[model samples]
Target: MASMVWTRYAAIGDSFTEGIGDLHPDGTPRGWADRAAEALSTRAEGFGYANLAVRGKLLDQILDVQLPAALALKPDLVSVSGGGNDLLRPGTDVDVLAARMDEGVARLRAAGADVVLFTGVDPAGSAVIRRTRGRVALFNELLRATAVRHGAHIVDQWSMDVLRDWRCWSIDRLHMSPEGHRRVALAMLESLGVQDAGDWREPELAPLPALSRGARLLFDARWARGYLAPWIGRRLRGRSSGDLVTAKRPGLSPVGK
Candidate 1:
């Protein structure tokens, strides 16, 4: 009888994979990649994790740096998240972004990676950057086609609206909170067909607690003034925070002293 071969995984992307705001105790990448790595380590015992995610990286930047590193790993499973930065730039040519992604995917496939999972940009409605929705959708479509062409898998990160709900986002309204990252990691585990270890906790939905009318109004105003307005202004200025949103200060009232 032949023994089963396990896949060695490598993750490549930008802040999302590096876990920008979700810092580790040492302030390193604590995003979905780390969580997925931990889960896979426990599940597969010997699966390798090579996470190469830079902060504020564009698609071209990833192709230039991280792609080569991932190829060198000769990973059996490669997970990628990108394209958000390309959407941030004004007058970005979608065709160019698509071509770069296609080229990167081709290189990874040629490197003998059997399973490649590409993540889509989260929906803009749940994100601080409002202008990116259209571009994100387009990039996701391109990524899906590219993955299919390369015989890889697709992890629809954008379609997980359950995680996009306000409860899952951090104070910045951009990056995923710890809970959100956990959900995203679980989804990746499912997509990779990796079973969870004893430590893996399943995500659950709970009913929203009733709030006083004044509390609701305060929350709504804060989200609008703090998140939405700044998001719009940044986009108009042709700037992007790139998964890094300044968290709201604690112990401050809406009308601060």
Candidate 2:
């Protein structure tokens, strides 16, 4: 870690950062952020890491709750991810969210931490999700500007063509599968200037088995009913999947400790 010196690193975000779709053997999420910490810890001795990300959290909750707690740890490096959950809600003003994000990130920068931000993925691979492509693009631009303004590092998920595959996503189509999380971890390490961390840009894996058009239609229908419908219902009811959940790694501790 000659080029890096962050001894205490903290992550703050939602399910994406929490690694919801990438479950460990014990069924706990072990996502890219955690993998990033492990990689950094290997390079730098006694590195500390904390993740305050919870599923179904909005940008507001991330900043309101998690951000302060992360700052309390006085982390030298922090990754801030949000707005994907906000994008799912109806009438979510991308501009307003970006503005709030700007403020929150500004605070992190003012705290003398090297901050990292992520742009949302290009959902062109998902037929149902591609409809929001324009909105995601606009939000990503604002995030780029915010990063430039605050001197924060930005991981460009939008440019990850490797992620635009069915194999990279979980069955629910909302979270990254194990393969996706692996490449994303590589991407984060690359952004941090970690040499020889592996090429995240490389596409790998066999193609999914072909299914008849009728079967595909039925699968989509089931997915919509089983996952999408309830998600929308939760939004309408003002409930969140994270209501009963708390941060998985709430405090900064030695990596893998």
Candidate 3:
């Protein structure tokens, strides 16, 4: 409602928080954070927003780099979503990572901000990512505990079954599509108890069509070649897509209509 809004909002995380798959007409990204900021602007005029998320960032990077900036802004609401990148790596102890994540949330909450946390989506749709589904589940469980311990709100994307549809995913099958980002923004608002007309839980227009045996094979090959191979190469070299990239909207600015 117009009467209730977070005057200052800061989002810190990885590609999910940075709005990777959601692209603007000018080749810029306008992820869920921006959508949520716009919604807040409509309700509370002059709502200021900052997004300090970059692609390929681990939870540590988020905490080390973005957390300080978010704290400096002293936002009324802070949304933090990360650790999906960490799950992709082998031998990653997510429980330990969850503990570190809890520290970040604790810091934000201690700064007197209402913090929001997110559980990662199940990546079972992808052959390469399916192996990490259990890890994702474990991280989600730990994240729930962290939220409870810190008195933070959660977006809970892991339980949103609508995200299981491939259409909600980008070509890389990692980041969310524009439609997915839109729904996430609605979900965030709903979690904050902000009433609006948007329906984030609406079903897809049509059921996904099953691919034929041959088509499935071809698709898998293409996916592996185009996205998976490059990603693996990056990991092998300890490189990241956000190696030199900085935050898209580093400073809090008034959201435009």
Candidate 4:
């Protein structure tokens, strides 16, 4: 009987890797990387995994922090999802993002990670909040080229889910919802030649509705509920809430008042 080769996997990237937008039942961010790790563990033989993703990270930051830390683990499979912050930041040129990605891939390869997976940038649809679609396309192209040069597998999520259907995005238009992340995780597994369990179901995302005043308000409120409310609650509880004085007069206070 032939023995199966089980590979240990490690994930490195930015907020997407850290599960920034999608929240777990416990209110923790359940990014696609964690989902991918879970899927791989359940299906792949002899798989060990580690997720080393931080929030608010750009390509340079990932190259500096995550690359070194993940390389230390010497994983057989490595997945990187970044560059969104780079695209959003000022003075972020294509060449810079490309260089950082190349360096990241080289370092991972040197660290004995035989299988590398790179996620492309998601589509920027008609959402008023997101950057121009052209920039996203450029980043995806650069990432694809870099991954191919390094012999790494490319997860064309930008094309697969985001562009294929605008519904794959959250109301904020920047991040993926839990359902979107699930689809992305499955795509990553498929790219890596890993099969999913029988229980995995594809999420049916609704179309992106036209932006209306009421819808915008509701969406903004939901965003606050998911992202900001927890942080505000934590700060309020830890500090002296009494010190935070409320304005007696509404119009005389800040804009929100």
Work out the TM-score per prediction. Answer: 0.75, 0.95, 0.96, 0.72
Model 4, 43-81: lDDT tens digits are: 555567666666655677667876776676667777777
Candidate 4 residue 219 C-alpha distance from true site, Å: 6.2
Which one is best on TM-score? 3
Q: Residue 226 CA error for candidate 1 (Å)? A: 6.6
Higher-ranked by lDDT: 2 or 4: 2
lDDT of 2 by residue, 1-257 (tens): 45676789999999999998898777889999988898888877778999999999999999999999999999999999999988865588999999999999999999999999999999887758888888899999999999999999999999988788878899999999998999989988888888887888675666678889899899899999999999889978999999999998999888765
Index of the highest-lDDT prediction:
2
When 1 and 4 are scored with lDDT, the better candidate is: 1
Q: Which pairs of residues have clashing backbones in candidate 2?
A: none
- Candidate 3 lDDT (Cα, whole model)? 0.89
Candidate 2 vs candidate 3, lDDT winner = 2
Q: Higher-lDDT candidate among 3 and 4? A: 3
Model 1 alpha-carbon drift over 4 Å, by segment: 1-7, 119-128, 196-202, 207-257
Alpha-carbon lDDT, every model: 0.68, 0.90, 0.89, 0.63
lDDT of 3 by residue, 1-257 (tens): 34356799999999898899998788888999989888887777668999999999999999999999999998999999989999988799988999999999999999999998989887777778989999999999999999999999998887888888888889888889998999999898888888863779885557878899899999999999999999999988989999998998888988742
Error of 3 at 63 (Å): 0.3
